[model samples]
Target chain A: MSDRSSARAARAANPDYKILVVDDEPDLERLIRQRMRRHIRSGRYGFEFAGNGIEALEKLVELPDIDIVLSDINMPKMDGLTLLQQIPEVNSDIRSVIVSAYGDMENIRTAMNRGAFDFVTKPIDFADLQVTIDRTLRHLDEWRAALASRDKLVALQNELDVATKIQQSILPDTFPHVDGCEIFGCMEAARNVGGDFFDVIRLDRGCLGLAVADVSDKGVPAALFMMSSRTLLKGAAVGVGDPALVLAEVNDLLNETNDAAMFVTVFYGVYDPSTRVLTFSNGGHNPPLVVHADGSSEELELTGGIALGAVPHFEYGQASVQLQPGDLVVFFTDGVTEAINLANEEFGLETLQALFEDGEARSAREAAEMILQAVREFAGEAPQFDDLTCMTLRVADE
Target chain B: MNVQAEHHDGVLVAKVEGRVDSSNSQDFERQLHEAFGDDAGAVVMDLGQLAYISSAGLRVVLLVAKTLGQRNVGISLCSLSGPVQSVFEISGFNRIIQIHENRTAALAAAGK
Candidate 1:
């Protein structure tokens, strides 16, 4: 089918097409009625009459769904070109077709710029009028479809904003106040929702659980997986007091029915301020760095294991490290080190270790902020691709 | 990104030959989903010609893998270049999805 006829067919299921005919000449009404007799007889064209631009505006206000306007260029009260300019103010969706005398090319140009869709010269040709009307109707259909898609996009953006907020709310807002230790954690997603998460959960008898994880994807899917992984880790840690057992159980649980085949790299550590010791296990996560008081820094050693949810019957290996009063342990996802700069260089582990070893970290929060600032500066003008997460714990004297 | 698909021995081999970033990952995902039919026993993505991939591309791969896994179909990757291989390794995606050295190895692993 032709584009015009196809557009008409699509709108045929809707209400009747309405048109406003504006002219000072009373006989013009009779002419339009006679010309559109076939459409009028078939209930396809419904007409509203107006003598001038002011009258047309009044009718348009009354019949807001008037799809088209056929107005004379030189009416007594308000001319058609002025009405064309004003029609958009009433409803930009309404296509205005200017009716001008022959050789009135100047007014037609002005009308076209003023938002007239098309023009039909007087001594109105009925066949030419039909073509313009059909074309205008197709434009209207295209506008409505564009508008519908725009509305859908707006709704989707609103939903994503809410999802981001919900994901943020699920993370720990305030760090637990524990004696002899300072803890702080933060996360930044590349998109509206991120795949990175961190926790500073309070355990029994002055013990704290510190975990930072990165899901292997992005957007909503990663965010969903991150949430479940976060919840499972927290639940498993509280039920069993060991880091290895917690990871082992969480991994097994995720593998039980993980249809997504998604996986997470996590570093889970249980710290006891009373003993100044940390018991931890690594699930293929980036190793956490330790900076001692004497300006020496090194990556902590943990038993090797793969990421969680990838395989069943996997055992998580655990290790322990004694902390000094002035030592700080910094745990981070790969987003920090793998962060690329305009030069395409990564903010590698050595820079992070040097930041702590050089006395840039006076507090846990300061260390986390400084590390993020370093990454941001290093990654200047480059787009972030992954979720960034960090958690820092500093051993303090009692 | 250009994604071409061909079926061989009941396996769907999707050969991606360009960068799959945020701008075109959705289209890449739609094309892959269209290729992943019920009767397709295994899906082998040949990324030998794939120049680069962003997290958005990885997200689509994860989604497709999850859907096919639920349907009891296997998915594998073959012929990743240096940069793409590092990305997969860094994100630990290499551990989750099996990666083969070449298309022949991938098809053999897929039992095609």
Candidate 2:
């Protein structure tokens, strides 16, 4: 009828479970042990016993699987409540119940406050004790299940964190040290993974390949496509003489198995340090902005072709730009100019070009930072929507 | 930074003040987690009092937003000051995370 009796009935229904009893009185301990053995023999319970809190803790340490502790509040060396405190430190999983002849309100409150499962008066009711054990066991099961799930979630999150780090590591660590070029670049992903990539690769003597690309979509799938496109571009560029031929090969390779309906917009170029010439190809990419030494800037308009993976025989067009001393070229993904500020104003190409007019950025690295800073200033408290990828190349005098 | 949260029309409104940088990113994240964990409702983070935010802070926001996204939870930010708004703009966060000019707008947007 009472809460305690119902709990005992529940435990009696599941008798294979283990419960630990802790008390200092030898006579009382023996009587309790007898009652427990009788219950176990009758298929009503299974029990373990300790004479004091210290011995009880020792038993708990030895057998962590023990499901419940029914303890006396007052004892020698260590009180029942003290043992309860130790249980949480050693293993908070163990549920505890306190039994005492001194059933004062303060003592009961202290025992409960100290994390006791339940408390019983000195004149023990077997029904009440059983009910407490049964309820405690049910709660223990739920707690254990919850803890296991929490552990699993934590493990999964750790794995995701490692994956994110691995994805980042695959990007080029530093810009290639080109003799006649100063480089600056940055990649900002909208998510843990992103689809934009920019890299400068050193080819054979006197040549460096600069690339800025955007995949059709966002997140992990797009990131994978970007990685593949980057690899194929690098591989093809190494052997191909013309930048257009390099992109054609990359597009063909991607188009062959492009089942995800994904495509990439790329501006790939190879600059010759000896000749001060940059031969480039555009595949549905944004026109790159070139800032000359005389404080003039213009967009390098390369005729556009379909994005890579869009068609089997996509023909990319090539163009050439002659870079003199103090000339700079800036290439970026759509994420940059499309970035919206708090007022919903885009950090458009015009803003980016204006930042370059000030002439503060002497090196490519500084140029990249300046552009990024301008975008940051413009967005002003808005959230990022896409991955921002930018690469700047400065031509130095021979 | 100091973060305080209260429930408004079943949505959790988190008020963030001070600078959000590497030093306080963890605290910011913990407060969000606590607020969202309490009620699986829309969250509107008020940033009117925020002075500055670094890339580290940006990362924290992204991480929380992504988590909430996966759970089909809606998150919006309101009342960003000039500096804080710029960081999000440059980082392209403005495009991904919902932003409103004030609390009323953010709350209204979240309702949709």
Candidate 3:
């Protein structure tokens, strides 16, 4: 299951690894050199000699490429532990290996606490020292690889920002100009990108098509789903006059390759300017409120359809409501009613309806803003869990 | 969320308690499956204590139901509170899966 060994083999094979040997004994350098003579002769490892911790620090600053330091514990100027702490200041990439008297567990533990990568003992077994060196280098290689992957994650976050822009651009920013009425929509996107979106499309013959949909996930995957659903809904809406039929076709198209089992709940409707009637259908979405001209609002009757991409060829029902003068239809996703406070209580439908039922009548944009503002106030200080998207259609008074 | 199961007349009654949102939906699925196994002729999810269920949790329930249905295993739900019931209805889960008013009725129906 682990590819660490192979990764080490591929990366740590030939680097002429540089190690600084720090010991007070003058003869110890020659012994290490003679022992590692073959590795030095071949282009595998290069060794540098330092008499003590201070000298090692100097050599390290002089030769910045030294990868590891093998230091002895006892020295007059400075100790191995002191050098281990200073190595990071000079080059964080370097690791220190401590050498001490055999069976000196106390000093070895202290060396480890001070950031020693590994240790060798006095009367050193050269074979053990070789193994320790290989282990230390392998650890360093994996550490660097992990840091590199972290950088890739940061790059991925930047890509998510681009996705946010694409999602924002997909929704129809400018509401369609419908005579005898005004349409406005706003989506307060959550911190993490969600799949909530609203669109207003100008159809043929002065009929405006409106849609608000919420996909079932968050982040890039849900953003992609939201984009495709928006495109498919708009594509199907242009030719199809019936809200039920448009959704039916979009459902089939989305189901074709829904390997992730993702689904979207859509409320698609078309408004005829001449008649002032809006025919709409629901796809397992929360029913929107119809705020009448007198400020009395009622929840729209659900047309009885499951979410799209769940059951293909599912029959959908549609109904129409005549938009009386001064009437406003408030369309919203669950994010509005389902917005939760720190107390873990949802801003339920009753609260939303009460807010809309107030006396003063507002414009399309103003109505949408009022509802959003109420939800935000209700969830004061609690992080917005989902995209708070709402659309309003206000018929101008005669 | 937590799932407790007790067998009654070949039915595995899973008593789901607490909230099941995106964070714990995976564990909910695992616990439900561990309780159901291959032998229960029918399953009933008792949701009287379940406070909230997000779309993610609903997806899991749908998955279990569809998968078990394909294997000829019957699954139903019971005792969903008002808000939870509305959520299930809005998602149209009530149409595909049977929902009983209480555990007694759920067991009675599953026993048949």
Candidate 4:
């Protein structure tokens, strides 16, 4: 159970209720105090006596923490109905329990409409009165608990909003400078915080490191894992010679500390502008699409490996392909192909390949935008379940 | 959501009906806890009539599964409708818990 709910349960179990008892009968106060002597001694309830509704209001003003008002309908200066109406105005948190005659159903109903929380007959049995008091306190506890949870939810949403901003800031806004490459990346989380990350880092010897990854879980835990994984990959990629070796080192590091059993599927590549050659590695990620200048596309199914954090000391494989001028390599997470439409049909790999097959010439940024637009159009009214991320790299004409 | 429970073939079968969204997930959790009690036996969840489930409902199901696991009570889910099955699949819950085709299969799997 969450802290808020547990606290509510505790309050319901042991309540230190304070009640103001108002009545016109002069001897009623002494009788009640005597009847509830054991309760008073135990510190479960503390009482303030009032002869009429007007006096009850005064007591309430002095002690705003008073939780309940036990009052008689017929009083000298003020009636119970009048006090009930005024009680809410002074403090809406206060609940009123009316004392009425045995046959006063009409007045009891009237008192209820006027804001009485509950009622007990004039000839009140002490045992029945005790039960009513306990029941009324239980209701108050639940009401307060609900209010507390509502406030906590508002605060939690604000914190998530700030977290979303922090996650967005972690991504690279500008791609690395590569003479023969134009690169772009975009990420959209289904929730305020998501587990998708992409980066383009300029490595040694004018080589650019490009990566896209998706974590296994959702929300803050996934977001935290994504940050750690992205940081580790970027830290290892800069000094490492091989893309597969970089992933292997990061995988070992993640496996050592991954207590949550969370894993990430990643595609990491290194592009050398001088050779127009791209060396890449895949760790259980979806195969990227390589679209040739002739408007034909092929799924870039490289040597495969399991996702990071699943096993330690696991070997990863590397593959290379030379990119011709005007060729495009588009990388994405499963969220792209698995995107569902209103009809519950996936957008699918065929549709993605078709889009690339018949598309016109565009920059990396424009192409990324077009794909995102198509996904949104396909998803019409269906809710997005996973984080959507995509990256595109185009070889500029020589 | 409405959950009805009955003992059949030496197994507790909980028939869940309607959408188990955030609005009533708390009540649903309470109902499950009340129905299961302290019996460390076999429990079968029949989801043949369940239409939808949200994250809140999933959280409750996880809590119940953990509690029952700790108590050595075997729990299995059966008869998931299409939409609910999709939710379970996407969340990776299908990997952790045992799921069967129907109540009879679930009972047999639980060794009832």
Provide the overall lDDT of each model, using Cα atoms, as 2-decimal numbers: 0.85, 0.78, 0.86, 0.83
Compose the digit string of candidate 1's lDDT tens values, residues A197-315.
99988889889999999876778887888899999999998999899899899989888877756778789999999899999998868889998876688988856666788767788
Which candidate number has the best TM-score? 3
Which parts of model 3 are misplaced by more than 4 Å? Answer: A1-17, A22-26, A37-46, A50-65, A72-86, A98-135, A138-142
Ranking by lDDT: 3, 1, 4, 2
State the DockQ, from 0 to 1, for candidate 1: 0.22
Candidate 3 scores an fnat of: 0.30
- Candidate 3: how large is its RMSD? 5.0
lDDT of 3 by residue, A1-398 (tens): 25865654444444468988998899988998899876765656788898888999999999998888999999979988788888899999999899999999999999999999888888889999999998998998899899999999999888888777777777667876667999999898885567899999888888889899988756667778888999899999997779999999999999898866678889999989789888999988898888876668888888888888776788889999887888888899888998889998899988987876665779999989988999999999998867889999988888
Task: State each candidate's chain A TM-score.
Answer: 0.91, 0.77, 0.84, 0.90
TM-score for chain B of each model, two decimals: 0.96, 0.94, 0.97, 0.96
Clashes of 1: 0
List CA RMSD, all candidates: 6.0, 11.9, 5.0, 9.5
Off by over 4 Å in 2: A1-18, A24-46, A99-105, A118-135, A174-179, A188-193, A216-222, A255-262, A309-313, A341-344, A377-385, B1-112
Candidate 1 lDDT:
0.85
TM-score of chain A of 4: 0.90
Q: Against the true structure, what is model 3's DockQ? A: 0.51
Q: Top lDDT: which candidate number?
A: 3
